[model samples]
Target chain A: MNPALVALFMIGFTIAAYIGSLHLYRKYRRIYTTPVIVATAVIIVFLLLFHVSYETYMIGGKWIDRLLGPAVVALAYPLYQHREILKKMLVPIMTGTTIGAVVGISSGLLLSKWAGFSTEIIHSIVPKSVTTPVAMSISESTGGVMPLTAVFVMIAGIGGMLIHPLVMRYSGLTHRIGRGVGMGSASHAIGTAASMERDTLEGSISTVAMILSAVIVSIIAPGLTLLLL
Target chain B: MFKDKAIIIPIQIAMLYLIYLAGKGIQNLFDLFIPGSVIGLLILFTLLSLKLVPEWILQQGVSFMVRHLPFFFIPATVGIISYAYVFKGKGMLLIVIGLFSTALVMALAGRVTQWMVKRREEA
Candidate 1:
């Protein structure tokens, strides 16, 4: 089989799968149907079923992966756009997110240690609470498995959304600021989406928290992971 | 979305790539621990805030990338297939950790922020 042909096929197939999954996600709106989750599943199944090696997939996959860095850099746009709200709630948001970042890193590290998981797993989960790109980068920098880190991040986002109501009820997180900060700080973009669906202000605050937490976690997770782990 | 001005999109993306390269150069030069993308984000952010880089330069390109951010992650996520051994028996444990830690962080962060807001109002 020609390598160029394989690369082209893999690239086109991935795009098509993502588009189809995106539609399914919009229509059904379930965690399992998330475009990335669904698309990855579809691709992985296709690879396994047809006996396609990950290395072959990477021939084309690397091109898509290359864009990830620039895309992450582009995140500054949203962060910049939301500067007004960020300015208004700087103190509380910062206070909440800093604490959240510490708890997020420490809890993952300690729990994995208690469970007897290996160092690799511990490093992966440490940055699980931040957004995917940042989390993946952190995972890479820390010698964690990038794929496992992404999966843990997805789990964290979904789990945070699922438990939002219960946590709010028992934790007295009634205020919109608290709700937003909590969701975004803990869950990243997916939690921000869930928060948005509940309240506009909460959603906006969640966006701010989401971006701010990324910066906070990025700066601190490496040092904190070493310190606590 | 750009209508006939579509050429601008790639150019803007190229501009972003240049910044990413600059960030990587800095990371290598200083032996910094942070990823170049994040450093690039900070550099671009500072440029935007300081009015050195016009927002319009990044408008469409950045939006396109951000909107389809999930798409870019698909390949990496798909790479999970290779890690079967790592996750084979730890499914339950991972789920428990994911759920528990997430809940705790959400509760505590929310509580602290709400408490601060309340105290500020009282003051």
Candidate 2:
């Protein structure tokens, strides 16, 4: 198979899976759940069954990954637009992110240690809640494997997607700003996307929180690693 | 309007490269400290906050990414294949811990932030 052609198939397979699952989700909303999740699972299974290499898959998929930085940079506009609201909530946002970051890293480290995880695994697991790119970087710096960090980040994202709504309902958090900040900070990008389904204000704030959380974790992870390790 | 679009693309790309360079510079400084991308994000945020880099550039790049961002995960998703063996040994435990803890922390963070904001408003 021509490499270029194979790449095309890869793209097609991903889109097709997404579309198919979306169709199913719309048709059977209650039973089917999120189309993206279903589609991602299907794609993973297909790839594994065929023994496809991640390198090959990425060659075709990197066109999308390259956009991540730019997308992150673009978030500035929404933040700019919401500058007034951001200014009002700046103290709460910063303080909350700091406390959340500390608690998150500490709890993971403490629990994993108590559970008798290996030192390396404890290091790998500590930054799992942050965004993938940052988490992978922290993992690399601290001698954790990139693949492990990536999987950890993905699990964190999915968990956020599944549980955030329930958390919101249980806590009775109706305010748009509060809800957005919570989702964005905790879940990272996936949670940010989930926030979009609620409203624009929530989405924008969530985006800000996602970006901020990534920034905060990246800054704090290394120092914390040294102290904990 | 036509002039604005004409002016925007070059400026945006230049800004991106500059941001990339700034990120690189920070990475170099922190080579003994942390990852470059993390440094890069911080630099980018600082630039945006200071208004040193115009909002238009960051806006164009961020919007494009957010809309089509999920596709980016495909590449990283490939990591699963490469590290299947590593995952086989302890992946399940790691996944469970990652999931539940992330949910717990996020919920707590959100609730705390909400409470703080409410308290501030009342005061």
Sliding window of 10 residues with minimal summed lDDT for model 2 chain B: B32-41
TM-score of chain B of 2: 0.68
Q: Which candidate has the top score in lDDT?
A: 1
In angstroms, give how far residue A191 of model 2 lies from its true place: 1.9
Across residues A171-195, which tens digit of lDDT does each residue of candidate 1 receive? 9899998999999999987687677
- Once superposed on the true structure, which residue ranges of model 2 sit more than 4 Å away at CA? A20-32, A222-229, B1-64, B81-91
Candidate 2 shows a clash count of 3
* lDDT (Cα, tens digit) per residue for candidate 2, span A1-229: 7888877887788778767876787788742266557767787788778888777776666755554554455444555566788888888877766666776787777777776788788878877777776788788877776777777777677677777777778877777777887777777776776676557677777776776777788788778867876
- lDDT score for residue A157 of model 1: 79
Candidate 2 docking DockQ: 0.39
Q: Report, for candidate 2, the interface RMSD.
A: 3.1
Instruction: Report clash pairs, candidate 2.
Output: A70-B61, A71-B62, A74-B62
Docking class of 1: medium
Q: Score the docking of each candidate (DockQ).
A: 0.56, 0.39
Candidate 2 chain A weakest lDDT stretch, 10 residues: A67-76
Which regions of candidate 1 deviate over 4 angstroms? A130-180, A187-229, B1-5, B114-123
lDDT of each model, Cα atoms only?
A: 0.83, 0.69
